[model samples]
Target: MNVSVSRNSSHSEPRSLLAGVLAVLVHLIFVAMLIFGLNWKDHPPEGMVVDIWTELPQPTREPVKTVPSKQEPKPVQEPVKPKTEPPKPEPPQSELPPEPVKSEPPKPAAPQKAVTTPPVKKPDIALKQKPEPIKEEKPDLQEQKKKEQEKVKEQEKLKELEKQKELEKKKELEKQKELEKKKALEKQKELEKQKELDKQKELEKQKELQKQKEKEQAIQRQREQEAKAQREAEAQRAAQQAAARNLVTNEVSKYKALILAKIRSRIVMPPDLPGNPVAEFNVTLLPGGDILDVRLSKSSGHAAFDSAVERAIFLSKPLPLPPDPALFGEFRNLNIKVHYRE
Candidate 1:
């Protein structure tokens, strides 16, 4: 028993050691995972950089108009001043060419400040440049207006396209929702159908099991009934056989009494007999109750009484017997005992 215990301990030690090692490894792995997760979560989120343009520098066409606006009024020629006088005050600085050309609509106040200053007159050389600059500025302003109108149309078109895309996305989402709903309904219906079939099968299975149980019970009951009936019949037959045996025993006793009485009557007692002596004989008889043979089974000590009893037995040739042929076997061989003195 000790050796078996030691062997069991030896076998279990490695398994226990392996389990302990695995537990330690799992703990280490869990700790590592925790460390990694903590380090990953602790880091700060990166910043997003955006560059905002405060002013768009239009240096090509806008420089010409802006420079002229600042310098042209400084050199207002005396002859051209009167001719351009009506047009100068009439043009509001808010509707300036720089607004359309440079795309700086919010800086309209800056241009109004510049344009509000009184014209500074220089020499006659600046007079000739004034009319030419005014002619060029007129055509540039018209072209700028047309470009601004085209930009507005492009913005409207982009907005309409974005709206159409949003509507299409909505439609697609609705369609997907409808499809998902349909699939869910179909799946639910299929599950219901499968459940119903399972229920039916279960019901059928229960029915079959019930039927089988009833059938087994019926078979068992039939077997028990048959066994019971067989037992009853056997008991009845045994009772009948016992009664017949008792009747035969009673009939045989009755015939034995009659034989003993006849033998007692025939015996002649001897006067010289001292005491009563019992004499036993084995007698063989024919079916007619006639003595076939007689043998002394026991002697009475008195010789005269024994002789007289034997002679008397021979005289009574035909003895009484049962009338039933079936009872003749009982009287075929008889044992008779007689006593003298009565």
Candidate 2:
């Protein structure tokens, strides 16, 4: 078949195989120099066949002989000197024995003399200062804002001096209430001028008691007009002396009613005054009428009841004298007033 495969014939190794293609092209150049030394960057990849070699079935041959002998080697030993005396130095072994007595470490006490602290006088280092000029805080903040505006103008002049001392204590309490209302209007005009001078001294004492009661009523009407003109001239001389002494106008009116019932039975009264049962008073009579003035113009609290109304008006003294000397001035002004009403 004219075959030989030594190597390159454009790879397909068939043109009659040249020495098995030159051992497969020396194992494919040892696998392309181991893939270009493990492929750095060229792009030549794909050819894989690496089987190395193992198909063997022929290797057998044998025959050859020869013998000869010779020998050598053995020797070594040299120190030898006799012993005796220098062993006396064995006494130095007591060195560790000396350490056993380590009792001396306590000698450190002898170094204690360093306690002398007396040199401490070094405090005079007071020299580092010099830094002062920083005071302009804006003129101490404008003198603390002018001492807070002069403490707010002394608190607004103490609130306008406490509102002018409260308007001078309200004008001194309204001038003490207008001087106590002008002293109560001058004590009500001096009590209305002392009530008009007590009504002009009570109208001049009631006009002097009505002019002494009209001059005692015109002196009792001129003593009753001279006792009625002496009773009409003794009644015309008792009718011409009763026609020449024959006087019997019914026994001259029965002895003039028995001398007015004997002076009204002695006009009694006094058991302490106030009487009025008819014996009122004027019983005096005679040119010689005895009981002159038995006091009480109006008395009653008495000296024995005004001496029992003056012994009952002197027991009605010479009283029956009414033969009419014109009724003797009505018993000569004998005013009496006794009133008792059991």
Candidate 3:
């Protein structure tokens, strides 16, 4: 019964151990899937190309004409006119006084001759002038070509900056996924360790209960053994006491007969005493068989015979007794009857 109970208590299920193994297997499978499922090919981004075209300006032209150099001349000046000789004036103012005295007659004489005057002419000169010529302008082409080249270079730089921004964004996303995976693995390990601790505590409790039960059983067996020993000792003591009592009773009976014989030897009977006489006496003795008192309970009816029996008892002092002191109480006080025949 003890062996069966111990076996049942000692054995336990291995559930926690099996759970730990299963968790490890699940983690391994997840790692394998990550390795095979993800895309790892290296594919760089494609670059873009742009084209520009411009037209050049055309030049303009103008026509030329000639001018003439001819001119006209000026007119000449006119001649002067002649004058009539003044009638002879003169000579004669001194003699004119004599001529005035005869004036009426002189007028009639001048009408015979009348005087006349002539016309005049003008002079001329010649001169000329000349004409002037015209000029043209042109355009430049090299400065226009330099401005178009600078515009094309600026557009290429802007496209390169946009491509760099896209690459940085992709790298940030990959880093975030890796951090999440690490956190999940740590949580799984903590749960497995907690389960193992709980299993160990349960096993310790079972062992303590088994030890307490065994201790109680041992104490019960010890108590039953002590009770059996006590009952056997009591039975043996009662048997020994019964054997001692029977031996003392037998020794007392033998000493009683010797005491009677000693008293009978001292008796002296009267010869005229009638009939057979039986007298009963009560004797009281000390532990050492010394007589203390004696009384006749039944008399033989003859005074002389009774007196003789009393004197015999007084002579037999210090009666015989049993060897064992423990039997003395039975004989301390006794009743005996004596029969005398003649």
Candidate 4:
């Protein structure tokens, strides 16, 4: 479809349109070149359109023509007329005299300033206006002797101090030994006193047993001489006594009024010995009238009083028992002691 247009028509005007096309075409070519080469691999798929707008240089106005400065014409100078004269003749090189000689005196060497340092004032070395000679140090002879003497003196002082300390230590040890010996002697005395008391108690117990045995023998002999009826009667009497103690103690709380009076009448107040001594003791008696043993638990200081107490205990052997079982154990060979007051 060719549409031919007339000259000067807007559609037929190709120059302006060609210029605009050329500008766009040039931009597209540049972008295509960048995408295909520099940035092609990094941005493979997307066509990165970059607007690279640049500012073009501004058009400069042409300089206006300036009138040149007119310089003043130099004065017209006439050629100088040469003087008409014969030239002066030059001196011959061989005949010329030597140049005037310059006078120079020999230079004296520069004088040196005096280089000596000023003497310093020396320190005063004299001792109080006394002209005593300096004594040489007796390093080899006198000092050795002095040091030896000092060493000897120091050694002697140390030895004396050591001896005094040793003497004090020995004295302390002797005192300790004496104290130990005294303690041992006191312990020995105590043990000896205890042994003597034990011997005395044993002897007293033996004597009491002998006396009880004699009394029992005499009673037995007397009973043997009596007739059968009389023996039976005596046995009955003993049996009654056995039951009496039982009946009394069994109802002791009820009959305490009667028992207290009976005990008080029989209780004897022994004589007072010297010391404020107390002997606490215990004993267990058998059914028979024989004392099995007498034990002294605590010892009174007085020997005669303690012995007397032990003797009393043995003499009161085989303490009466209650007939009934309920009251039997009340005084059945149980704990007791000899109680006496002055």
- TM-score for all models, in order of appearance: 0.40, 0.23, 0.37, 0.21
Please, what are the lDDT tens digits per residue for candidate 4 over residues 167-278?
Answer: 5465456545644664575556456545545654665466456545655555565556565768888899999988986667556544333333332344443566664666
**What's each prediction's clash count?**
0, 20, 10, 0
Better of 2 and 3 by lDDT: 3
Off by over 4 Å in 1: 1-200
lDDT of 2 at 155: 76
Error of 4 at 267 (Å): 84
lDDT of 4: 0.46
What are the candidates' C-alpha RMSDs? Answer: 38.9, 81.6, 65.7, 63.9
Q: Which residue pairs in model 1 clash with each other?
A: none
Off by over 4 Å in 4: 1-151, 218-342
In candidate 2, what are the lDDT values of residues 140-193, reduced to their tens digit? 665566567547655755665575566556545655564456456546545644
What lDDT score belongs to each candidate, Candidate 1 first?
0.68, 0.45, 0.55, 0.46
Error of 1 at 46 (Å): 98
- For residues 46-147, write the lDDT of model 1, one tens digit per residue: 675666743332333254456545544543333235544543432442245343323433354344334332122221233455445655767667446545
lDDT of 1: 0.68
The top-ranked prediction according to TM-score is 1
Off by over 4 Å in 3: 1-219, 269-277, 302-305
